[model samples]
Target: MATQSPFPFLDDLADRVGEALQPPPWFVHEAQRRIVLLVNHVLMQEPEAQSRLARHKGSVVEAHWRHFQVRVVATPAGLLDLADPAITPDLTLTMVEPSPLALARSALQGEKPQVRIAGDVQFAAEINWLVDHVRWDLEEDLARLMGDAPAHFLAQGARGMADALRRFAGAAPGRPPAPPSGTAR
Candidate 1:
């Protein structure tokens, strides 16, 4: 027999709470601004990435996931700015998987969710290259804020935690078995 959840009404309660606590329009705008700032911070680290983006300056890329959507255009400085609503997007990328939990799981596993791409093929290629190549050097950023040694230690600890979580997630219900040790079965 299958075990039932201890709180059967929790899902309904969560839905109600989520609807009631919808973020204000200003909050959404601020959040998007912060996201753009963070993306630019990462982009600034790699000159080549900036150069590639500069080629696509003014081209709008719209990304949609669930109810959230953001459109960004490359600036002359090779950084991203919010796209004008009146402008048509050059490319659109839609997240195929809608569930936040599934997306988080894929991220923790160092995988990307399937995305449906539409519009300019060359622009899409550039975006794909950016996704594959651009990565935030969190440890380096932390070192700038704190000392190098402390930042290294924190980064090491974070990696260990991530590994442990990955192992745990892999061993979850309905997951496939871990690979066998080198010996013949």
Candidate 2:
């Protein structure tokens, strides 16, 4: 019997990122580090999972482990999940939504994405919210994983995601979307 490949998309992603950014090894390393850090932060904030995934790190385990069930995808829009129709996002955002974060981290950590993991197999329509908001820098390897789009776009998506998180964190107890810096609505 042959061993199964962990990340089947990695080879293709490597090619795409290599062709898109052609970044130095260090930059690629940095991007990977940042991605994992962001993912870790998302995982730590979940309700019942903080104790289980304290030690794992890096994309190898993150990409293959089933804890968070967060599968990184490369589409014309960027990275996102195959599930979650609401976030059918085009540009990749940090996994920051409370519900998705719980599911994603659980999947990545080799656990399960909620009790209905089976439903998560569905993919959603691609949305452009992240592309329209925020800013960021992308490493070549990271770009390739995202199908080799220009790095600036990915960076913007990241920024948008951060903005979304900031808004969520700053929102009133029962209200949605915190008001902007100095405006009362």
Candidate 3:
């Protein structure tokens, strides 16, 4: 059975609103810089991901969604840097989805957006490996700012909330699984 939304106009409204709100050049550049920093940070924690990226050294990968685009080059140190806009990218990943509402719903359902991949096959494979293997450890990152116990506490709460949300948006709730081997439930 197909469930319909009461407010179907919201999707169209969101698309129109997004089209109306054009960000300044500075905002786009700043957002891209932040994205590079975050990506590099996650890559640094995974030596294998970095080493794989290092093999591609100067290879540039450009990602596109609608009018926004970002180009990043693999660095010798296994990190990523904003690539020169004039340089042609070795690989390009263009997301096929256009609606923000659909993308958000897909994300909530733990699904990947469809993407059109182009260019260097080896570089693309390396990127695919990184995507499958690398993940940011938010709890560990939080531990750096606060104490371990407090970080764990907050992370646990957040995880539970996320799990509940996932259940609501996705699969039906089943019996709660036992906690990992160690620590009380």
Best by TM-score: 3
Cα lDDT, all candidates: 0.83, 0.39, 0.85
Q: Please, what is the TM-score per model?
A: 0.84, 0.24, 0.85
Off by over 4 Å in 3: 1-8, 171-185
User: Candidate 3 clash total?
Assistant: 0
**Can you write out model 3's per-residue Cα lDDT over 3-46, one digit (the tens) per residue?**
34334688678767777998998998999999999999999999
Error of 1 at 121 (Å): 1.1
The full ranking of all candidates by lDDT, starting with the best, is: 3, 1, 2
Q: Candidate 1 on 1-185: residue-level lDDT in tens? A: 22333344764565566678888988988899999999999999999989999998999999997667899999988899988878999999999865555566677778877899999898899889999999999999999999899999999999878876776655657765454345364
* Residue lDDT tens for model 2, 1-185: 22223344754565565567766766655665577466444434442233222221111111222222233433232222233324433222233322433343344434422221112211211112222222232444467676566665777777677666667654544678766567778
TM-score of 3: 0.85
Query: Which scores better on TM-score, 1 or 3?
Result: 3
In angstroms, the error of model 1 at 130 is: 1.0
Model 1, residue pairs in steric clash: none
lDDT of 3: 0.85
